[model samples]
Target chain A: MTRRRLQILMPWAVTLGLFALWEAFCKISGIEVFILPAPSDAWAAGVEFWPQLLEHSLQTLFTTTAGFVLAVGFGVLLGLAIGSSTLVYKGLYPVLVGFNSIPKVALVPVLVIWFGIGTVPAIITAFVISFFPIAVNVATGLATIEPELTDVLRSLGASRREILAKIGLPRAMPYLFASLKIAITLSFVGSVISETVASNSGIGYLMLAASSNYNVPLVFAGLLVVAFLGVLMYALMALVEGRMTGWAFRGTDLMS
Target chain B: MSDPEFHPADFMKPADFMGPADFIKVDGVDMTFSRGEEEVHALRGLDLSIPKGRFVAVVGPSGCGKSTLMRLLTGLAKPSAGTVTLEGAALRGPAKGVGMAFQNASLLPWRSTLSNVMLPFEIVAPHKRRLRANRAEYEARARALLKTVGLEAFADNQPWELSGGMQQRANVARAIVHEPRLMMLDEPFGALDAFTREELWSVMQALWMERGFTAVLITHDLREAVYLADEVLVMSARPGRIVHRQEIDLPRPRTLEMTYEPPFQAHVHSLRDHIQTVREAH
Candidate 1:
């Protein structure tokens, strides 16, 4: 009970301590807020521009989530295709690895060429960056099935389709959820990168515009919102993972 | 129906030598498994006859292709040479109307005990077609099978929640849930404690007495073979073939106490001696 409570509380304590130290150091040094806005300055900016912050935050959130949902849908299907057969696994795995290696930011200008310099490019960038992890994790899960399970299912006269449907997909679920948590945060990075490059309205665009106008407090406020939303989405995914795939969570000691 | 390229029946010279009435037969079979650059011959000249509704046990040393034999019976693997037939028909692919259980008690951890037991109904023939139409009936059938294996109370429990013995019991229930014509058990009780093993022995015996499926059990324990089987066959070391066959004429409803008697001990010792000889020879 104590451990569970400590797990939830400890990170907040650390965050508060770090912010306090940072705030104190800035006050003691008499650093200008333009150079490095204090936590108080960022907080004041956030409250002062609450409506504008929310509007832009919602834009960033929608684009990121749309791309993430696309990644999940496509990633699982691609993973299954690669994982189900040795032939497909060998043929396509290298291609996927090569694709994942290319920096997604480079794809932003290309996406801009295809779609205009706006939400579409941001959504595409989010998808390109986030989908790789989901695909790889799910593929790894299915490809490494227990031989005994296959033997039993086959000896029962289950077809390949049946085996994959009944066993392979369910076995990959924990991996899928784990990837979702990672991919969700990565999607935010993807969206912000594209937005910074070229987008009309999002926190990333707001930050870029504010920084250009020397609004340091507003820039810091945007950063806070992005981090806060990223962490919140990640926590949501972890909760869903606990509820949906708890059975797959074997003792961690066994994994080593 | 099996392979047209090589008819299994023709593999045996003098085909009628194996009585026509035999329910299952493996004739002059040879199974070879090849790795990257090396070939390992796992079975040779493996001939066997299982009469209808008989309980048979195969005992052999480790690395003696005992598992390979079980795999062949299930039609999971075809012989490199010769034939394996069930009820006078060639087993080409995975044999239909068959059930199998391994030593590991391979219940999918995510599923409840009853769901695991009902797994075959989701994949196998008429059951799969009938499942959506008769979900309640099939579930009742699964619960009944679990009851037979003394797992009725744990029907809704996850597999990991159960002890090893309890899981094995569920495994047994899963294997028999479809009411198959043949039951192939490979070291089903090999992992259990002595007391739990003996307890399951009675459970198996009761199940066999009631169901009367043709059971071909592959086990290393001679005592297990002699205690549960109507006839026990001792297998030679790798390139495994039946070396000796002992028919247990002991009366039915045999108790665990009978396993300690002179007659039962005699069968166990002889079977042990045969396996010991095969092991040493190899």
Candidate 2:
């Protein structure tokens, strides 16, 4: 096979090969179904529960998207404020770091107590967990502008507003997009953690429901669905990142 | 006259030889900047006067406040004591109608070369106000400037797509696109290879000749200072001040070939000697 074709097919081949190995291990060892279901059993569970699984996945997607949008808005504003002012940067950075260090899963219970066990808590959890990377990356991007570039603009009598508009924001775009890919995945983790703890809908809730009844295959199926969704969202973010900030990666010879 | 021995006292007040109606003047400027707890005395008791439409270069040892001089002339910083005047007016802030280019090309990587060249139009007024209405005219002017710098073909290319030399060419086009009357170059050609640097020297010369903008270049290259400037100023060590002034009476429209000739080498040698003497004295 050609190199390009091999590159495209490699991931699929490896994934299927792993599934085959897992299926063989279960068939030979005769492991208990509750402990570990075979790949075939998981596949059967997915096929049978397609409608419910789809609904849960869609709920998860909705909460994650809503939370991610909120994150983008608040994160960028906070980033601008912090990046533009030394006072804000010094004051808020420690607080942000402290908040980010706490396990986001630990906050799901608090969110449930405040918002009463539903989609609201899941969304708020996602927003809180995922916004840190975006805010930090944007601030870093703005802070690290080449002094020479600023000198050129300042010598032209560019005001702070003009400098921010022309250079700061656009320069921070790559950093923002980079954090989006990371933040979107983090949003997924946040949403699911909340759903598993408190919400009635989403893949995490579905998995929790299945596990209670000792339906190991159904739980595995839900997990597979969530993993697929995470990959899909990450791919979408990569696409948008390429479209928006191709110049940042131009050194890699990926774009003309 | 033959062996120009360097002497700080003889050149201390070179302003006496300066023309009456100086375009840019630094009068007894003293610049001291603080870095953390330590106060760094950069430039001290410095005096410089540039005639209108003359190309001047300042060459000195490292840390001798050559950059500080450029900052004062451009009015990017106020001297702690003395006044920096441009065209008979004391500059309160960054001088208006001045173009600056730095050692690095420093082009916005996202912008195409043409867009980069048009940047001053988005900042420097009344061009900023007129730019939208006369965008075609301004674009044409930018394109023409690019052509002069030999970058007309790469105007649509990103800065990363171009070679380092081409990027610097684009940088020069961006600097002159707004047609500022005063141009400040901060070791603009310092990063390039020798051949590329020499090639750009000609491009720079042609631009200066065509525009007649009063130019100040800060460089460590003795040959570059001698080859480009109408006069070269040498600076003393820290608490820096101009210590020697040498006029290059060499004829204009100077070429790369002319740089090979004895007169050019002689000028370069003397300036090198002055710098060596200045460094040792400190």
TM-score of every candidate's chain A: 0.95, 0.95
lDDT per residue for candidate 1 within A104-185, as digits (tens), equals 9999999999998989999999998999899888898898888777877887777788789889999999999999999999
Which candidate should be chosen as best, given DockQ against the real structure? 1
Which run of 10 residues does model 2 chain B get worst, by summed lDDT?
B1-10
Indicate the fraction of true inter-chain contacts that candidate 1 also forms.
0.63
Clashing pairs in 1: none
Which pairs, if any, clash in model 2? Answer: none
lDDT of 1 at B58: 91
Give per-residue lDDT, candidate 1, residue A75: 95
Residues B30-140 of candidate 2 have per-residue lDDT tens digits of 999999999999999999889989999999999998888887887677799988767666676666557889999999989999999999999998999999999999999
- Runs in model 1 lying further than 4 Å from the true structure: A1-4, A250-256, B1-18
